[model samples]
Target: MLTPIPLLIIPLAIYNIIAFLTPGVAWTSGLAEIAMMSGVRWTLTVSDVFLALCLFVLLFEVMKATRISSRSIVDHILSLLLFVCALIEFLMVPQAGTSPFALLVAIMLLDVIIGFSVSIRVAQRDVALTAAPDQ
Candidate 1:
């Protein structure tokens, strides 16, 4: 179960390597350009980065839930925030051109929803674990 975290690391590490190797597709600038083309106002902001970080943290929390404990308060709060930010971003994306902003926001929205579901499941599991055993 704990192996899942390390399994995820492989793909993440591969992505990092590919990103580093591809200088032509500079991730941040490409993302900004896609946002601009799609008419997403102010897509590149500190809030976006913060939301990404929050998603990463949520992923870790989910991994932890699979192995050991249930979802924590921090996980739930972060996931909720991620969902909110994604919704705002999605709603703000203008219908002009091929804006990847909408796509990105959609991905974030999915992640947040999944995180929330996992949190609820974890909470239920926690309750079950804490219940007194029958005589």
Candidate 2:
């Protein structure tokens, strides 16, 4: 079973690769390259799609992390490690160091932090509940 935290990488990697390979066209990539509808021009870029994906994964991570269990701890820890990797990659790799990608990395970092905090809160609540005196 794959956790949401690690799943964050797929979108990030896809976005970075597409962005890097494309020669700064200032337009969309893949099938949805360009669009014209309702007298408005729009384009769907890799970063745009992947950012949404990362956000969706963040929601799942938050839900799973807030669950009261030991695995939640491991999930958040792995998330933090992945966050560090993303941060380093964004900082050191020119190809992947775009503003949009950096923003995504920031969002992923937030997921790690929130996941750990939420897990801790949930774990504390579980301990308190189990330790409560029964009649």
Candidate 3:
């Protein structure tokens, strides 16, 4: 049995990692496909849902980076690499230009930027406090 936090975090982390690591193809990946008919008919795939999940996770990461009191350099650096990898995949990989993963990459980049910016401000404030004597 896993604790609540790890239970929630682990699956999402794995999903993001797998999604990032897996090679892209002529089409997006998904678990299931849905058929719809309205004037015309089309199949909507799980990749659409994955995009929503990615966006939700991105929101979580950004908020966590901003709200968490402790800042880890390694975490931010890894986020940078994540962003870079996604960017490279988008530019170089086949069919990625038409996929949602490109948006995920952009979100990762924003997360890195915001996380570093907030961490720097927090560090500066801490330095000011530590340097000042009790007054």
Candidate with the greatest lDDT versus the true structure: 2
Clashing pairs in 3: none
Model 3: per-residue lDDT, tens digit, 29-122?
A: 4455445555544545556665666667666665555444433565676677766766776788654564456656666767788878988876
**How many clashes does each candidate structure show, in the order listed?**
1, 0, 0
Across residues 34-57, which tens digit of lDDT does each residue of candidate 2 receive? Answer: 557776657677657767787897
Candidate 3: 10-residue stretch with minimal lDDT: 1-10
Clashes of 2: 0
Higher-lDDT candidate of 1 and 3:
3
Model 1 has an lDDT value of 0.47
Which clashing pairs does model 1 show? 38-99
Q: Write the per-residue lDDT of candidate 1 for residues 1-135, one digit (tens) a residue.
A: 333232222333333343456534433442342346667766454335534654575476556534334324444455456557545644663331123344445444555566567667756776754668899
Highest TM-score: give the candidate number: 2
